[model samples]
Target: MAALMIQGCGSDVGKSVLVAGLCRLFTNRGYRVRPFKPQNMSNNAAVTEPDEQGRRGEIGRAQALQAMACRTPLSVHMNPVLLKPQSDVGAQLIVRGQIEASYQAMAYQTRKATLLDLVLDSFRRLEEEADLVLVEGAGSPAEINLRQGDIANMGFALAAQVPVVLVGDIDRGHVIAALVGAKAVLEAEDAGAIRGFIINKFRGDPELFDQGRREIVSRTGWPDMGLVPWLAAARSLPAEDAVVLRGAADGMRQRVRIAVPILRHIANFDDFDPLQAEPDVDLIYVAPGQPLPADSDLVILPGSKATLSDLAFIRAQGWDIDLKAHVRRGGCVLGICGGFQILGRTVADPDGIEGRAGSALGLGLLEIDTILGGDKVLEPCRGRIVDGQAVYEGFEMHIGRTTGEALNRPLLIREDGSGDGAVSADGRVSGCYVHRLFDAGTARAALLAKLGGASEGVDHRVAVDLALDEIAAVLETQLDIAALARLAGLKDIPT
Candidate 1:
C-alpha cells in the first residue's frame, strides 16, 4: 500500500506532532500504524533495536513517541540517518547507530543524496511490515535550491509516490502565505504529491478559520484537511530538541532545590527528565540575570555541545562565583559531560574544535584537564558507582580526555577495571561525563536516600511510563484516527 506523507510548509510547522497524532489515531481505529522520518537532525535520540540482523541505527524522540503509541518495540531503522548538530555549521552523523562521520552544512548537502537508498530501504521495510506507514517530510519542498536532489521533502514524496498533506502553522501568522506560497513555488509536477493542506495551532473558535480555509483552498486549489484546534496537551509531549525541552528533576531531600544553568551548547539536557518525575524535588533553570533561585540547594551544570564556549559562558555569568559560594555554604554541585570538563582544568581547543585558538584555565575544582581530542566517546558504558555515590551504570558520549583527580571514591568504576568521573572530597561537588544517570533507578533511590526521603513507593521510571500511556490516550482521542487509518490503507486489526 502507498504511504501517507505529512509534508510541512516549513520547519516547526507541526510535522512531527501531526505524524504522532496520526499514528495514535490509526492505532485506536484498530490498525497497526508506524512512523517514519527519512532523515532527522536531532541530538536528543534513543538507541533502538537493530534491523537487517545487525544493520543498526539510532531511535529519535519522534519515533520513540510513535513506538509508544503503536505499542511496538523501538527500532533504529525508524530513523536511519541522524545528524546531531555539535556546532552551528557541522553535525555529528550517526549512520546505522554508529558515528560514521561529521559534516558541515554545505559539504554535507552534496553528500546527502548518497543516503537516499538507506532512507528508502528503511521506509519501505516499515511500509511492508506495518499496516500503515506515516512518513514525515522535513522543511519545505519549495526550497528549490536544494529540491533538485532533496531527500527530505518533495523529493522524498515523489520518490515514494505518497500522497502529501501540507501543514501550515497559523500561530506563526503567515499561514495563508506559507500555504499559498508553497503551492505557488513548487514545480507543477512536484506539487502533485500534495493531496490537501491543514492549518495547525488555531487559537480561537474553529469557525473563525472558515473564511481563511476557504481562501487557502480557493488560492492553492488544495483540499482542506481541517483546521486543527491547538492541542494544549502537546506541551506535555517529549522533546526531540534538547534546546527547547527540559530534563526531569526528582528526589530532593526536602528544602533542597537544584538549579541547572541553561547553557548555549547544552546537549542531552533531557538527562534531568526523570528527575522531574519526583514530587518532592524542584528543578529550576538559572538564567544569567536571575540570581540562582534562593531556595536552590544544589546547582547542576549540564553537558554542552561546545565545551570551551559553554565553559566560558558559565564563568561569565558569575555562576562560577555563585557555585563557589554554593560549595562554601555546604551546598551540592554536580556537573555532567562538558560541564564535567569545566569543573576541571582549562578546556583546550588547540585544534580549534570549539573555535578556540588555545587552552584556557580550568575551574580549579577537579585535578583534571581535558584537551579536545580527535576521537569522540560514543558508547553505552556500565560499571559500579564509585565506592559510594548516587549515580549508577550510565552511558558516555563526549569528545576529550579527562585526566587527574583523586581516586578514593570515584563516580563510576569500570567492570573492566578502569575508573572514570570525579567526586569531591566532601562528596558534594561531583562531575561526570555521563548522561542518563537519572534514568537509573538505583541512582534515583540513592539520591532520595541522601535527601532524607521515604521514597519506597516512588518508582520514577514507572511514573514516566504511565505519563506516556496517558499521552498516548490523548493522541488517540483528539486526532483524526479514522481518516488517518484510511489514509494509510492499513487492514483492520483486532484489539
Candidate 2:
C-alpha cells in the first residue's frame, strides 16, 4: 500500500488543511484515499462510523473532516492515539478508540513508546483497505527533543517508512529560515525522511517568493513541492487546536451578536461553526478577563473537556454574572455537552472522572442536575427540536446523566421518544448533549429566527463539502499533485 505524510514546521502550519485538501484532490481523481494520524492532541473529537458489532469510537475532529474529504467513513484507526487535554500538563489518553488512561506531560513521554506497535497495527489495517493513506503529523517534527518515543511525527514516519513533505507557514514570516532550520536541526536519518517542502499561506504574488523558495531548496536539498496561497475556504472547516481561538473572533458588529465565553478546556467548539458561517450572525469568543458582550443576542456555553473545571472558569471570568444579567435582559442561552452540565443546578463528579471527587453549584439557569460518571454515550441520532417544527440530526458523545424538574420540558425529542436535554420554564435557557445540532438547516434557521437574525438559507454541510472541493481545486493548481503522488510511489495519477 502507498502512503505519504505531511509534517509541518510547527502547529497550525496548515498540515491538517493540506492533508484534507490532498485527500479530496486524490479522491476526486478516482483513487480510494484515506487519512491517518498516528497521534493527535485535541479536545475537538468526533465519533467514528460503527463497527460490525455496532460500536462507535472517537477520533480528532480534523481526522473526521479528512475522512469526509476522502468520501469514506470515519474510523478510530485514523487517529489511534488521541490526547484530550484535561489540564495544561495532563491529558486523557485514548488508544485504538477506547479510553486508556490519563497521564501528565512528562509521564506520557515514557508511555508513548509503548504505543508504537498499536499505532503501527492501525496503520497496517488502513493500508489493507486504502489505495493511498495521507498521514497528518501532530504539532511538528521539528521538536526533536520529543523525538525518542514520539509516535506523532518523525517517529511514526520513520517507523512506517512513509516519506514526508514538510509544510511551512509563510504567512507567519521567516519561511525560508523555518524550512531550512528544521532540516538543520533534525538528525540526518530523520531529515532524509523528508522528500520535499511546501510553503503554505502565501498571500502576495507567487513570483515574489520564487527566489525565497529556491533558497530553501538550496539549503535543505529538498524539492519545492508547492507554494499554496492563503485559502479563505479554510475558515469554513473545523479547527483542531484551541490555539486558533486567540484572535478568533472578529471585531465587527453584526445583526445578531452571539457571545461564547472561551472555556480554558473547551471541547467540540466546532459546534458553533454553522452559526459563525451565517452572515447576520457574529459569533464572539469572549476571552478571560473580558466581559461577555452586553449587547449580545445570545450567550452559548460551549462544550468543555473538564466540566467542573470550566464551570469554575466561568465563575472566574465573572461570566456567571454576565450570563445571569443577559438572561434577565431577555437574551437566550444555549449549552451543549459539558456546557449543558454547567447550566444545571449542580454538577457532581463523584468518581473523580474529571478531577476531584466532589460536586459544585451550577449556574442555576435550568432546574436539572448532572452526575459525571457513566459509560460515554456515542451514537448518531436525529430528533425534533422540542417546541419547534425543525428536525435535527447529530451525534451524542458525552459521559454522564442529567435529571431534574426541567426534564419536564425537553430541548429535543429523539426519534425513539427519549428526551435528550433540558429546557428552562421560561424557554430562554436550554441545554443539550448533541453536538453539531446547528448543522441542520431548519433547526439553525429556527434558532436564528428566534434570535432576530436571518439564516441566509445556507446548508452548512453542503457548504463544507463545497469548501473541501474549493480547497482541492486551489491545491490542484498551486501544488504539484503529480510530484506528491510520485513521492508516494503511486503510478501516474488518473488525469
State every prediction's TM-score relative to the real structure: 0.82, 0.98
> Residue 474 of candidate 2: its Cα lDDT?
100
Q: Please provide, for model 1 over 1-495, each residue's C-alpha lDDT reduced to its tens digit, 9 standing for 90 to 100.
A: 647889888877778777776666666666667788877887666656546665434656677777766767777767777777767898877776667767888888988888888888878888777777888887788788888668888877788777788899999898999999988988998887787887887888878778988999999898786767676556546566654533332324464466788776777767776665556667676555545554576778888867777777777877778887778777777888888888886678777655545787877776677888776665566666765544465567677887775434467777786776888778777788777776767776676566554233344445544555554565455445445445545455222
The models' CA-based lDDT, in order, is 0.72, 0.91
**Model 2 over residues 1-495: C-alpha lDDT tens digits?**
889999999999999999999999999998899999999999999999875567788999999999999999999899999999999899999876778778999999999999999899999999999899999998888898999998999999999999999999999999888999999899999999999999999997899999998899899999999899999999999888888888766669988999888999999999989998998989898888899999999999999989999999999889999999999999999999999999999999998877767999999999989998888888889998987778888898988899899988988999999887888888899999999999988999989888888997666888889999999999999998888898997776653
Cα-based lDDT at residue 164, candidate 1: 83
Top candidate by lDDT: 2
Total backbone collisions, model 1: 14
Report RMSD for candidate 2. Answer: 1.1
Per-candidate RMSD, Å: 4.2, 1.1
